[model samples]
Target: MALSVVMPLDISGESAKYPALFEKMGVDFTARRCTTPEEVVVLARDADAIITEGSQCPIPREVIENLNRCRIIAGTQIGYDTFDILAAAERGILVTNVPGYCVEEVSDHAMALILACARQVVALNEAAKRGEWGFGPHSSHIREVIRARMDALGGKTLGILGFGAIGRSLAPKARAFRMRVLASDPFVDAPVGQEAGVEMVDWPTLLRESDFISIHAALTPETRHVFDENAFASLKPTCCLVNT
Candidate 1:
């Protein structure tokens, strides 16, 4: 009998490609649009392997304990936080995830947002749409545009909350615009920050010093609500924050 594989997520438009791919690998593949732990238990109980699609389709401890034959659980996304790793370990089932997924794309998007905020791009675009052409000094809307006051990125400070892969990738990009970069992460050392041309600082220092702050931290208990009311109050009045 061929080994069975089950995917417990609604893969949407990518449904057609999975069966052919699995068949070529000599495995019996089944895709279920499972959105709950009960659904996962029913669909993957007897499978040899399971594939998941990040936190959206959680495979909790209950589901892991119910699996009678599953030997591996592979996550298609970068984070496997939703998986019951301890339960899988007890059952001798390997848990894995794609760590390099979207590193560049996420950093690029963060940079785009930083630029937009510095230039007041959205506000200016909205003003233009309202027939407020404020380019010329004599235009009636010139005063409004002057009040918009776009700041230059050069000589500004950018603080990165998590100095992991995506944060490292964003450092040089910010440097190209002549922005000073600071980073804070317990896992990353000062040498790594120096190598990336960024200052290694504490979280409070990063919050107080940055003109623009970007968050690249993983979603976990410790990282959640990091920017609470106190943190918000610490930021400069003109500071811009981006998370993408």
Candidate 2:
């Protein structure tokens, strides 16, 4: 008998490729758009393996306890915060995630957001649509537009909240634009930061000094709401933030 693989999430349209890919690998794959823990428990109880997008379909302790024959719980995304790793381990099931899947793509998006914010691209585009060219003394918001600063990326500081793979990828991209990169990660050491060509700094220093800040940290008990009121208050008035 072929091994059974179950995906307890809605895998449609573009995601339909997964079924075909699994077929080529000779696994008996089933994609069920499960919306509840009960649904997952029913569908994956006797499966050999389970694959899911961790963020969308949470596999809590209760669900893990019901996966009788599952040998592995594979999260197709980088973060697997939705799964109960301890519960899976207790049941002899391995929990795995794809950390390198979107490193470059996510870093590129962060850079795009940083540039767009620095130049006020969206605001300018809206103004242009409203027939405001932001010049020649005829525009109503000329003062605001002129005071937008819209400074170049050269010589500005960029602080990254995490020095993980995505953050490491972003450092070189920021350097290419002549920006100084700083990073803050309680788990990362100074030597690791040095190797990545970023200055290791505390959160306070990063908040105070960076002209642009990009958050690349995984959501956890410690990092949840890390940029609260106090953090925002510490930032430079002109600082731009990008969270991805």
Candidate 3:
């Protein structure tokens, strides 16, 4: 019998990459369109292995009960808090994910967001297009933009919400800018956080102290919507939040 493989990404031989990869691996596989969390269970119920980019669909202990043939689940991207690994391990299901799969692209995107925020890219571009230069006699139009920053990244604290691969990846870059990094990850040991030159702190302490906070956390039941109203309200008013 062929090994049954189910991928949660919508696939087509014409443009999709997986078909060719499976053919190369000499494995039997199927891909389905699963955009919603609800659609996951109905389609993944019988899958021997699930290769997915999205993981919101909870793979609870019950799903393990239902999946006898399933041996492994491979997440296409970095985070897989959607998969209950502890439960899966109890049931002997191997879970894997591609780490920092698109490192350059992701870092580039984050840096771009930070720079755009610093350079007033949106406002200046819009003004330039309309033939509007500095309205004030001496760089006055940019005064409002100046208010947004009031301070640059240097000498500012950058609190990284998670000390996983992505957070560690950004640390040196943030440090290079002469910014202090404070990291909070329940799973991270004090030694590791210290090795990164980031002081280990509680979530509330990190949020309150940071001038620029970047979220690099994996979404878990505990972490989903973790940055809700109360969390945001706790941040310093001058702080900026960046999500990736």
Candidate 4:
């Protein structure tokens, strides 16, 4: 008999190609979308593999305990915080996630946010829409505000919170704009940062020196709300933050 797969999420339009792809691989599987835990328990009772998107549903202890023949639980997100790993492991089920799936896209989005904050793009566009031309003597206030906020990217320092795939991808992009990059990741080695042309620094050093900071760290007890009141008080008043 072929393997049975159950998708416990509403991935209709997004996963239109999954059926064809699995068929091409000669895997005869039945993919069913279960929106709730009760539905999942019913549909996946005889399933061999369970697939889910991290946002829609969480694979809780109850769900794991009820799976009859599940061997694997796969997530389409980088983080598996939604899944109960211990429960799955106890049931002899492997948990998997795709970490490097959106490295470039995420890095690009972070860079775009940094650029938007630096240039005050939204404020300027709104001013233009309100019939305010930032030119001549009458617009001195606008020009002064722009001059006070806008700074060139070259020679600026960019600090990254995590030195993972997305952070590594962003370092080179920052360097391309003639900006210095610093990273702080307890899990990564100094050599990794050096190879990516980023200097490994302490969290305080990165916060104090960087003109812009990009956060790429996962949400954990240690990293959750790392930029608290004390951290904000240490930053430069002109610094911009981009959290992805």
Provide the overall lDDT of each model, using Cα atoms, as 2-decimal numbers. 0.89, 0.90, 0.75, 0.86
lDDT of 4 by residue, 1-244 (tens): 8787877665477577778887887665565666677887887788899888866877888888998889999898888878889999999999999999789999999988888887788777777776666686556656878656877789999999999989999999989989999999999999988999999999999999999999998777799889999999999988999988
| lDDT per residue (tens digit) for residues 11-118 in model 3 | 654328777777788778777677665565666676778776644344556565667678888777687777778878987889898887776566556656665665
Which parts of model 3 have CA positions greater than 4 angstroms off?
Answer: 12-17, 36-46, 55-68, 84-92, 135-141, 145-150
Stretches of model 4 off by over 4 angstroms after superposition: 12-14, 23-36, 136-141
TM-score of 4: 0.87
Off by over 4 Å in 2: 12-15, 24-26, 134-138, 146-149
Residue-level lDDT of model 2, residues 21-114, one tens digit each, is 8899898988888889999999999999998988889899999898878999999899878899889989999999999988999999999999
Model 3: lDDT equals 0.75
> On a 0 to 100 scale, what is the lDDT of residue 45 in model 4?
81
lDDT of 3 at 95: 88
Task: Give Cα distance to truth, residue 135, candidate 3, Å.
Answer: 4.9
Which residue pairs of candidate 2 clash?
none
Q: Candidate 1: deviation at residue 6, Å?
A: 1.5
**Per-residue lDDT over 197-236 for candidate 1, one digit per residue giving the tens place of the 0 to 100 score:** 9999999999999999999988878988999999999999
lDDT of 3 at 112: 62
